[model samples]
Target chain A: MPLSKAQLLAWLGKLDAVYAAKKEYLTDLDAAIGDADHGINMNRGFGKVMEKLPPVADKDIGTILKTVGMTLMSSVGGASGPLYGTFWMKPGMLLGGKEELDAADFARFVEAGVDGILQRGRPERGDKTMYDVWAPVLEVVKARAAAGDDVAAIVDAALPVGEKALADTIPLQARKGRASYLGERSVGHQDPGATSSYYMLETLRDVLHA
Target chain B: MKKLINAVENVVKEQLEGMALAHPELTVAFEPTFIRRADAPVAGKVALISGGGSGHEPMHGGFVGKGMLDGACPGEVFTSPTPDQMYACAKAVDGGAGVLFIVKNYTGDVMNFEAAAELVAADGIKVQNILIDDDVAVKDSLYTAGRRGVGTTVLAEKIVGAAAEAGYDLDACAALCRKVNQYGRSFGVALTSCTVPAAGKPTFDLGEGEVEMGIGIHGEPGTHRMPIGPVDALTAYAAGQIIDDPAYTRTVREWDGSGWAENTLTDAPFAKGDNVIAFVNSMGGTPLSELYAVYRKLDAVCKEKGLTIVRNLIGPYITSLEMQGFSITLLKADDEILKYWDAPVKTPGLVR
Candidate 1:
């Protein structure tokens, strides 16, 4: 499955809704160890992304992502701004001039975005960070694509794993972001970063599969 | 929560706008909070930049004038600034001479600045970063983000900024900042919790009788909590950590019978005749009178130890949002560090 301009816009819209639905859960998790603004920031960031979508619907994939990146950079003032902005920008940089993304191209795009997060955030796998979920999702995506699965199947297979990974973040010790400040007290609380990562991938799945 | 602002979200941007307008000699970047010298893009001079969360006023941004930072980025309240913001500042200030990033030791600030440094390095400008971890608060014991970069950040910024203004290269300036950080140590005690505006409540709950000791400047919990006592005893306890002299505790025990380290002083970090640069800093809500009270006891301890106060910087240099507390810092300085300390500095938060 390849994502069309309309599909991408619909995906962005769906992502906004997903974040809105999960806002309280995310905010509650953040309240335990962070500034308690993860859900609010994501809702606001994706909402802005949605508003910017209609104007750039016909642009190339790279241009769309870069627009999202720059917008989030300015709109979101916290750590979420730079981390998520880097996520969208890296994919855009790799997919520049491409009209649409096939399964392999999209997997590589996600992989590149993960690499950007790792480089920018420097989070290790068990840091109880967004990397905890993203690393596994990126791996699963790469593995399925190499095994010749369709985009729909690969995304479908990855979302559950991503969700599981997010849930697993609750038991791990946090080593980055605001939660890291809590040390042992941060344990037992779900990582807000991991929750947001799940929402992002879920959006990609919806856009490509719908 | 009753802060003076147009909107909670626009606080940093509006403040930077005010800074830009108020000081015609300084330049402020609104999008990502950065303060730069008005006559920036000066060729062949190393550019110095430092930034962290926004609530610590006159900090990185305040110390951005003539003798300090060439540029300073501001993040949201208690949140670190992003990489792109730092990148923009670095690109704007990067003359042919390269740039130095003076970063605090917080994980978020360090990671974000490192990311920006990588991006700037890709553009072929040399970049170096020096992480300031000067708080002598307990480490590896957990409960907070390691040792925070506290009072020493002021000294590092002013000294390193002077070195850069004198045309020193990036590596030399970075080394100078690192040298200052290594020579300095700070410890803070909180009389009350701070109210984060967005949270609209105090960060933590402290009872009427308790005071938090060994706290980071960012409203994080401290190493210990004890009942609030008289100013003299609290000050002497705070000072003893810095002076670390057995004779000082012996003298106090002989005279006042109140010094904290009378029995354990020998095992402490400080010894006699140490040359120190002392600072009595207030958390946002603390008044100068309380700080002076702490300083008074600290001065007595110093006198007994035979330690000399080579220089003293006292004020609210680093703070949480309206937290009622004060910190004491002692920099074991040498001749070179002291000379850099006296260098001229002008910024919104610090003007000397």
Candidate 2:
């Protein structure tokens, strides 16, 4: 089945709640190596996205996603702002005027969004950034779609790969963002950006399954 | 955190409100949160706009006035301001001459300001963005996001603002600003960690007798921690870091009209016989008297190194929100830079 605009909205709503509930957890992770505001930034960004959703509720998925991206870009005042803002905005630009996305279309959307993240952050794999999680997850998404899996199955198959990638980030020394300032000390701490990306994927899975 | 703030969310807004009430010559906008001089966009003068996280007071905002910045954008505490704020402030402050964005080298600040520059350029307004990265503590630009922009930012704003006031065009103003960044170096030490109001706890913990050396403005851990000692020893250590720092090269992104371009820049080491502007800055909570003590040793150190101090500024000009520490900045000034440094500036945070 194709993923409807309603499912996309539900995924964003679930993300808002997930970030709100995990704000302190993410902040604590960031406190270990970063400036300790990831939770506050993500929660605040999603809150702004929620406010912008009602206005674009009846619009195409591209418009709704673009609104979320713009709101986050303007509201979240951190590196994540532009990083994640482009993540959604690029996909929105590619998916312009689309109201529903099938498994192949959704896989392409994820691929394009991850490309945006790469272009904006210039983060390589093993850099202990959100790209670590996204890179592996994107691979799984592309493979599952090529295998004729449904949208729900694609997301389900990608979540465990993402979770493992997030865990693998704990041993890698950061080479980008504020965490890179820690050098060797950045090891042994799970990357806050990867963890947040995992939560986002997990939220999508729940929305798809429901 | 035991702060004077009424709520975590309203901290930046409330403080900006109080600043607006105090400085009538400046105008504060809340919707996008930017501060500008009351009489901005002076006919043919180039507009200077700067911004960063809000906790470092008397910086971008407090320096907005005649002979200084035309506009300032304040982000959340230690967080960069959004691009929309920069675009709006640039539009509001740009005179016929164009706008120059003085951005620090933090990842967020650099990206946001870059985005804003693109927006402004697309609108057909002439724009240029210059980056300041003077902190000497961070060694490699290959791994981390270069050196954090520190005390030199204040000095750059004053010097570049004066140049703009003296009829420097967009390219000239940007070139001079870049010169200031290359000519300056800074190093900081923290006595204690600070609490971000939202986090409600200290960003890091330091033992009673330990100090974080090579610290940045943010409360993150520094290069290393050492046993706390007398004032003179710490002052010499910071001064030594700046004086002894080797030449550094990094690739910086510049807005080239239509898109971004990588520009490689180098910061040369300070040498003997170089005339310098010695700045002793408090990290918010340090008393002025303690800073004087720091300066007392800094002066002797500069003399010992054969560097001449033509001008000196001592106080909490660029701070870290009561973090109980201080940083030392040494700018090797040339004739032109010295002339602009001596120019008149009137703002809430600085007056000359």
Candidate 3:
């Protein structure tokens, strides 16, 4: 089955809830190497996304995603705002007026969003950023869609790839973002950004499977 | 953990409200938070807009007035303000000339301000974004976010703001801002960590006998920690770091008329006999007497290093909440910089 607009909205809702629950955990991870505000920032951004979703509920998926991006851009201060804001906004621009996304469409959406992150953050793989998760996940999604898998199966395959990527972020010294300031110290701690990115992917999977 | 506030979530809003009430000359806006001069969009002059995290009191916002920044955006405490705030602020303050964004070197500040500049440019308004990266603590651009913009930001705002007040256009304002950034260098030592209201805990823990050397303003861990010592010894260490630092080179991104362009910039090291502006700034918790003590040693250190202190600014102008520490900034000044420094200025936090 193709992923519908309602499922996308549910994914956003799940993301909001997950971030709220994991705020302290993500923040503690950041505190180990960063400024200790990732959880707070993400929670605030997604909370704002939730508030904006109701107004755009009847709109197309592209419009809904664009609204999420715009809200995050305006409300979530810091690197995540522009990085993740573009993450959604770029894909939304490509997905304009789409009511539902087939596996191929979803793959295109993820690829465009990941490309936006790369453009905005200039993060490369193993730089210990959200891109670490997105890069591998994008690869899996593209491969699965090409194999004629549905959106659900594609996301299911991408989730474990994202999970492994998130785990791999540990033991890698950060070369981007505030965590990079810690130098070698950034290595033992799991990257908060990667963790959050994994949660986002996981949320999408849950919404799609349901 | 004990901070004077109504609630953690309401901290930034409440503080902004208080500032609006206290500083009638400055206009504060909510929903998307920004503070600007009451008489903003000044007839034909360039508008200076700068912003960063909120905990740094009186910076960005406090510097908004006749001879300084035309507008300032305050993000959540210790977080960079969003692009929308900058876009709205640019719209609110862009005089006929143009708007220049004075961005700090932190990733969040740089990215958000860049986005805002693009938005402003797309609206048919002329815009430029210049970066300030003067902290000498971080040694390499190959790793980390290059050098973090520290005490020099305050100096840039004052000096470049004065030039803008004296009729420098956007390009000129941006040029002078960049020059100030290049000529200035800073080093900090933190005696303690500060508590973010929302987090309700100190960002880091520092033992009583230890101090965080080469600390940034955000309470993040410094380059290294060492045994704490007397005030004179600590002051000398901080001053020596700035004086002895080698030249720094990095590539910075600026918005041209059309798009973002990369520019390789280098900050030359301070030389003997250089005329300098010495700034001894408290990191919030440190008091005036402690700062005076630091300045006394800093003045002596510069003289010993064959540098001349032509002028000085001593206070908590740029701070990181109530963290008990201080930073030293040395600006190698030319005649033009000196003249601008001496220009008359009036704002809620500064008066001359």
Candidate 4:
């Protein structure tokens, strides 16, 4: 029922691989409504995080996460840099010195990450941004955690919700970020940030199963 | 993707290297790339900093030197620089007087600069971020990212950078920059979309005779597209937006030494008999002859409207990396602005 730092490191490594394999696909999705570098930038950021993660693998979860945050902030050059970097950095700060995380800690971690993103980007649900996924996905995460699920079940439960949220990004007009430049034309394209968010949760689910 | 570079990833690095080699007065630092004046941290003077995506060459970087930006942070192609770069650049150039950040209104640039401002202030350096939203095409900020900062940024940098060089305090320089921005309006049209090296293709597609109106620097799909028209008609259309724009009221956030302060500002419409600086800027691909042609039409329109082009900048001052387009910026220059504009500058892009 507990997720160890080892598993967290493995999850990060898996994320590095997943982003590397799917970088072009992500960029393709972004090409529809936004600039087509979401995948490349994410891959580059996570790749750097992976290279930096090894030295801190023995540290507490918070330290590991903060390292990833700093790596992404410096390596990534787009809105994703600060957004995803904050997502990790906030959870890491809250979970400092912890050797492992239980369901409550994991739920609070996701919640803190979402709150950090909200504070940084100021986006609301249906803005056709990553927030569109985070709002509903957080609801799912909180419900699963409250129901006494472990990190695996909580993340497993949240994966489909995140994917659906990604799909739902279609038909929504963007009101934030570069996609807003397209206005009504931004509809019918899956938000790239939402897609990456889905991938992130999906990576966690795969880590749990492994 | 036929480019002059030997490799795509090395574009920014090689450019920085070339800049450092060519200009002995500038210092280009990699590993979180930033370009600062070789004589940075000029004591007793306010330090000016500005940057954005790298593709808009000769902008934040080329303008970094004697009478312009004290430092600049260049990001990936058409992408905003990260906060750490800005923070490092600010720390490298901050005089005891303070530092002023000239930021474009794009979401990434605004967020990055805001984050950097907080980080820099925590390190005990005074910081103020002045937003430039002079592009009049977006129409509304409630639903959009305000107006995209374009040609007006060029004018702001030159004007405010001179003020800083002339010993204005941080608050006074920020006020002058804000005034310059409020009085400036810009509009641009694109004959072709720019091809980012990373994207490996044009940002958007255009037909043989199609043209995009109200195009932003990043090749975002524009307000409208129409059949290609004569240069005179096209220039007139873009000029009309800047000239006839009604008073626009918007709220922007400013850093007031301690925390963020929200200031609601309004821009008055351009009136007759105004003395102005008419800037005709290329989007990088257009040659000077075409720019002059656009300016030729812009001059006629201003004359008919009773506006005088007392000074003008005609060239690829703020470009979109070989995107075949041009933008026009007109600022009602007061005596202070004109005097500062005529101040001695020795940047790679501008020399006076």
Candidate 5:
């Protein structure tokens, strides 16, 4: 089924909830390798974005995504601002002028958004960044959809890949951001950013199934 | 962890509000996170603008009055301000004499500030930049980014800001900033890690009797970890890395991206000067007494080297929000730079 406007908003709302739920755990992970505020920062920023969503609720898909991008950029701190901000903004640009998006268009927009994020942050696959989870999920979603999978199935298929990627972060030495400063100390900790990305994508899956 | 902030996420915005309300003399545009001198468009003075993340308070913002920055931009904690905000600030602070931007040598800060300078230049606002990479922590390292910018930022802003306030043209102000940066070297040590308010915990763990050396102002991990020892020894460890070596001066001159700009000034004396400015800065959690203690040790070091310490400024000028640590910065100065260091300045955090 195509993603209706209500479904899109609902997905964002669920992502916000998932983020709030895992906020402390995320902070715990950050405490080990980074300044340790990724979870709370994302929750607070996404919460603010949700509050400002009502006025723009009736806008097109492009408008909604762009609004999320700008809101996150202003409200989120650290690398998350530019990373997730680019995530939503690029997809928004790809979906420009479209009032609604079908499954294929949604998949294409997601691909474009992920590409933009890669360009902006320059994070590689195993650098223990959010890209670790995001990259796999992007591939899963793209492949599943290409095989004529339903949107909900594609979402479900991608969710586990993201979770697995998040778990895989624990053994990897960080090669990016503040965690990189820790050198060997960065091992044995899941990247807070990657964990949060899993929650984001998982929430996206749940909302589509709902 | 014992900071007075209500919430970690609210710290930056709340501090900005407090700054604006506390200092009515400063023309503050809270929109883009910039603080300009209330008497901003002061006829012929070149505008001096500098900024980084919010935790390093007072370095850029507090110095935005008389002898320092004409405008300051504050980013979120540990994050560089966006280029759009910087371009807007440069435009707002321009006095028709162009602007000099003092940027720390961090990848994000450098890239964003450079973008802002280009954006401002497209509007015909002449802008030059001086990158500060004075912390002698990591040099040509693969594991870490590079040497961080620490306490020297405070001294550079003051001397260059004074030069601008003294009616030096854009080239002269830029030259003055470059000279200060070239002659400056800084090193820091942290006793306890600072907690980012939002995280509600320490950024790093220093065991009860341990200290991290060569730390930066933004709570970044440093080069070495040693058990916490006497204040004097810690001071020596930090100061030894920053001062009393000709090789240190050579490194400073070579690393400065803008050092060559000062070649036009016939009075550029850092390559052959005796006067120096010593600034010891707290890393948020430390007190004034501790800062003074570090300052005294730094002074002794300069004395031992037979180098004249002509000026001294010490305190919590820049901080990282209750991180129990301090950094020592030394800027080899000249007669002209010394005059500007004594100029009157009034702002919320620094009033003298």
Candidate 6:
């Protein structure tokens, strides 16, 4: 099944709630490696998104997504600001005028979002960044879409892999962002960016299930 | 947990309001927050804009005034301001000569400034970026996200701002700024961790005697740590590392007219008889008396190494909130740099 504009808004709200609940946990993880503001930054960004979202809730998914992107870009303010901000803005621009996203369209949307991050952040996968989680989840989505799976099934299958990918970041030494400063010390801490990316994917899965 | 704040969310805005009330020379804009010189759009001069997180007071914002920064964007505490703030500031301050962006080498600052530059350029305004990455604590780009731009940022802003006011065009100002970055080296030591108001507690804990060495300006842990040492020992350790450090090489991104351009730059090691400006900066909570003590040691080390301190500045100019710490910066000064550094200018944070 494809997701409507309402479902998409719900996904955003769900993501906001997830960040709200997990902000401190994410911050604790970030404190281990980063400057220790990931949770606060994410909550501030998503909280702004929730506030600005009401006015555009009736808008098309592309317009709605663009609004969220701009809000995140302005409010988030760290590496994540431009990284995740562009992630939404790119797909919002690409998926313009679309009423809803089917499984294949969703896969393409994810690719465009990742492309935005790649261009802005210039980070490679396995750098213990958000790209690590996004890259693995993207691969599964692409394969599932190519195999003709629907959005619901593809999301369900990808959630576990994305979680594993997030877990996998614990052992990888950071090579990007502020956490990269820790070098070997970064190895044992779960990557904050990766965890946030997993939360994003899990939001997608739960939205689909509901 | 104690801070003189109204609320966590309102801290930045209220602080900006306080700045506006105190400094009438600055025009504070809220909504899309930005602070610019009241007499901005100084006709025929290239405006210089820079900003980073809020806790570093007297930085990009407090420095915004005549012959210093034309404008500064302040983000939430310890957060880089958004691109829209930069874009708006650029357009508001451009004097038809162009605008030069003085960016610190943090990933967030770089990305947001890049986006703002693109936005302004698409609107037909010329903008150039000079990235400042001068921390010598982090060894190389391999282990860290590259060296963090620390105390040298303040010196760069003052020097580059004077150049811009003296009719050096955008390109010339950028060149001078980059030269400053290349010639500058900084080493920081944190005696105690700082609390970002939103975080509600110290970023990190130090046992009774533990101290963080080589720390970045954002209260982030340094490259190493050791038990607390005497003031002279801590000062010597930081200065020794900087004075004896090897050459540092890195590739950084800057903007040409059309696209992002990469420049490979190097930090030449300082040697005997090298004329330089020595700066001892506090990370905030440290007192002026302590900084002078630090300067006392630094001056002796420079003299012993035969490195001439042609000029010296000490105090809490570029701070990282109320963190009890210090960073030493040494910038190799040439004739041009010396001339600009001594130029008369006025700003809230710096006056001579």
- Candidate 5 chain B minimal-lDDT segment of 10 residues: B259-268
lDDT of 4 by residue, A1-210 (tens): 878888899889998999999999999988888888899999999989978987899999999989998888778778888888888999999999999999999998899999989978889888998988888989998999899998999988888888888899899999888888788889899998988888888888888898
Residue B94 displacement in candidate 1 (angstroms): 3.6
What digit string (tens of lDDT, one per residue) describes model 4 on residues B1-352?
8888868888888988998999989999988789999999899889999989999888989999888899999998898899999999998998898899999998888888888898999999999999999989898877766888889999999999999999899999999999999999999899988888877888889998999999888898889999999999999999999999999888888998888888999999999999999999999999999999998999999999989999999999888888898999999999999999999999999999
What lDDT score is found at residue A93 in candidate 6? 93
* Better structure of 1 and 6 per lDDT: 6
Misplaced by over 4 Å in model 6 are: none
Residue lDDT tens for model 3, B41-145: 898999999999999987979999988999999998999999999999999999889999999899999889988988899999899999999988898998777
Q: Which candidate is the best by lDDT?
A: 2
Q: TM-score for chain A of every candidate model?
A: 0.94, 0.98, 0.98, 0.97, 0.95, 0.97
TM-score of each: 0.88, 0.97, 0.98, 0.97, 0.80, 0.96
DockQ of each: 0.28, 0.75, 0.83, 0.71, 0.18, 0.71
Among the numbered candidates, top TM-score falls to 3
* Residue range with the least summed lDDT across 10 consecutive positions in model 6 chain B: B136-145
Chain B vs. true chain B: TM-score for each candidate?
0.89, 0.99, 0.99, 0.99, 0.89, 0.98
Give residue B261's lDDT in candidate 2 (0 to 100): 84
Q: Which tens-of-lDDT digit does each residue in A21-111 have in candidate 6?
A: 9989988898888877899899989999999998888778789878988999888888999889999998999888889998888998899
Mark the 10 consecutive residues where model 3 chain B has the least summed lDDT. B196-205
Q: Which regions of candidate 3 are displaced past 4 Å?
A: none
Model 5 Cα lDDT, one tens digit per residue, B1-352: 5778887657888887788888887877866677788888777779888988877877678778877788888887777776667777888878899888888866456545655675677788878877776777754324443456667788888777777877899888877777777678888889988876655667777899899987887777888898888888999877777654334322221112322221221112233336678888888779999888887777787777666788787788878877898888778776777788788766666666
Q: Judged by DockQ relative to the true structure, which candidate is superior, 5 or 6? A: 6
Displacement of the residue B286 alpha carbon in candidate 1, Å: 1.0
Error of 2 at B93 (Å): 0.7
Better of 1 and 5 by TM-score: 1
Task: Give the C-alpha miss distance for residue B305 in model 1, angstroms.
Answer: 5.8
What are the Cα lDDT values of the candidates? 0.77, 0.92, 0.91, 0.90, 0.76, 0.89
CAPRI-style class, candidate 1: acceptable
Q: Please give the C-alpha DockQ score of model 4.
A: 0.71
Off by over 4 Å in 2: none
- Give the distance in Å from residue A45's predicted Cα in candidate 2 to where it truly belongs: 1.3
